[model samples]
Every structure is written in C-alpha cells, then in structure tokens.
Target: MDARRDVFQAIADPTRRAIIGMIAQKPVNVNTIAEQFDVSRQAISLHLKILAECGLLNIKQLGRERLCEAKLEKLNEVHEWVAQYHKLWTGRLHALKNFVEQEALQPRQANTDNKKKTKNIHKPKK
Candidate 1:
C-alpha cells in the first residue's frame, strides 16, 4: 500500500502551514523556502516531505534546483470535515436560541395572565 501521510497530520505544524501559504502564490526554490524560516534547511526539508506525502505540496526538479508548489486541493478533505460539524453546531445553536426565546416569553405571558386574574378577583360584598 502507498504510505501517504494524513493531510490533517501534515498541516498540524504551524511551520508546515506557513510553508504551504508561502508556496501557494508561486512555486519557490527549496533553498529559498528554507531561508525564510529560522529553522535549519534540513528541518524545512522534513516539513516539505510531510506536506508532499499528504499531497498538499508538490516538488519538481528543474535543472539543479528543486521547486515547491502548493497543491491545496487536498485540503478539501479538511473543509468537508469542518463543514459537517459546522452544520451540526449551527442546528444545535438555532435550537438553543428557540428554546431560550420560548422560555423568555413564557415568563412574560405568565405575568400578564396573573395580572389579569388579579384584576378580576371579585371582592366579597360588604
């Protein structure tokens, strides 16, 4: 079986995410990307490996230089996963809002009914 890394695991690192963003605009030389970070070039290369495994980054060799390009379509997995939860939570929140509004109105309705009852309470004839 092909041992591709999970996209979620790959993006969990802030550095990797930054690298993806940096390369997303345009393909960047591997050395240029390494220079932008405080970490060693070796460290950046490891991050690059994980991103490539996740199918989020593509590395190409042109002459003696390697260029990294962003392949963000893989992130649709993350987006679809998040959208499911978003829909679930949105429904829950809407239900909670309706319950709270009903609870709020019930108290006002009860007070109004009580006031009307008190006004109509007949006094015993003197």
Candidate 2:
C-alpha cells in the first residue's frame, strides 16, 4: 500500500510554502516557478513533488513544459484543525477578561485592610 503524504508535512518547509503561495496566484510553468527562488531548479522540483504528493498542487504537462496549479482545497484540513484551537483559546481569553473585569469592579478591601494594619503600627509598641 502506498503511504499518503500529510499536507502539513509538505508545507513545513519554507521553500514549499513559498511555492504554494506563488502557484496559488495562478498556474505557473516549472521554469517560471524555479526562477523566482535562489535555489536550483532541481531543489524546486523536489519541493513541487512533495506538494503534489500532499495533494496541495496539480501538475499538468503541456508539450515540453509542466504547469503547476494550486489545489488549495486540501488546506481546509489544516484550517479545520486550527479553527478548533482558535475557539478554545478565544473562549479562554474571554473568560480571563471577565475575571479581570469582575476583580476590578470589587471594592478595594485589601487597601482598607492595609490601612487598618498601618494605623496599629503607628501606635507606639504597647
């Protein structure tokens, strides 16, 4: 059985992420995609291959040239995963805000207590 590549694994490399961003704007030929980066065509090709394996891109051959097109729908998996944490963190933050606001609304009992203690301290050592 063939193992499927994870989309997150494919995008883990900065080069691969950049390639995805570039192709997402429009379908680009391999040569054009390679030219944008400082890396060799071979390295870029490897990145493209990984992205293709992850289902993040579709490569179509046209005569001698291969055009790479972005298949961004695969990213929905990543989005869904992140959205879950986003909700959790947002709820936690909201709860924290409410707690802080409630604390602020209460009277300055600690300050009053400190003042009472200070009054006793000023009265000479009985």
Candidate 3:
C-alpha cells in the first residue's frame, strides 16, 4: 500500500537489478553489496531502501551488520504481468514462422512446376 515505491520502479535501475541478483542467491551484508558497485555507499543504500519499500527485499539487523535478503515472491508481480504478453508474442511468432515457411515452400513448388512445363515443351513429339 506504499505508493511512494513501486516494485517495477524499484527494479528499473541496472545497479538495483544487480543488487537484487546478488542478494537473491543469498543474504548479503550492505557493505559487501556496496563494494561491488562503483557508486557511493549512500547511493546503494538508497536503492536498498527503495527495494525494501516495495517489499522486494527484507533488511535484517545481524548484530552490527545490516543484511539484505531477497523476498523474491514480490517478483511474481512482474512475472505474471509479463506472462500475459508472453502468450500473445508466442502466438504471433508462431504465425510468422508458419507464414515464412509457407512462402519458402511456394517458390520451390513453382520451380518444380516450371521444370515440368519446360520438359513437356522440349519433348520430341512421337
């Protein structure tokens, strides 16, 4: 219900996406995540905050360290939205393949018909 952050907008950044990928494998410390990027720790922290706001991440206080963990179920929103278009694109691409294949076969069939006509015309009348 937090309109301030949206999952899609949270994931739209390359750095944020990389951070998500890293943590999705396993929980990682905020410092460790910051080390992987050229950006400032503050910048990375902002990205982490946005991710947390959108429910895509869960930040844990592990003693003195903050750990970022992936709550990847949130990604199901993206997956479901994309799946709707996946079916449409799959059907369209299949239809395109069928059309191209049929067009390719058409020329070969025409050539065969031409060859039959030429053969008939060249045949010596008995």
The per-prediction CA RMSD against the true structure, in angstroms, equals 2.1, 3.5, 2.3
Per-residue lDDT of candidate 2, residues 13-115 (tens digit): 9999999999898999999999999999899988898899899999999999999999999999999999999999999999999999888866587778889
TM-score of each: 0.87, 0.82, 0.85
Give the per-residue lDDT digits (tens) of candidate 3, residues 62-110.
8999999999998999999999999999999999999999999999999
- CA-lDDT, candidates in order: 0.92, 0.90, 0.93
Give me the candidate number with maximum lDDT. Answer: 3
TM-score for model 2? 0.82
| Model 2 spans > 4 angstroms off | 1-4, 107-126
Model 3 scores a TM of 0.85
lDDT for model 2? 0.90
The candidate with the higher lDDT, 2 or 3, is 3
Please give the TM-score that candidate 1 achieves against the real structure: 0.87
**Candidate 2 clash pair list:** none
Extract clashing residue pairs from model 1.
none
Per-residue accuracy of model 1 over 50-94 as CA lDDT, tens digit each: 998888888999999999989999899999999999999999999
User: Candidate 1, which segments miss by more than 4 Å at Cα?
Assistant: 1-4, 120-126
In candidate 3, position 23 carries an lDDT of 95
Sorted on lDDT, best first, the list reads 3, 1, 2
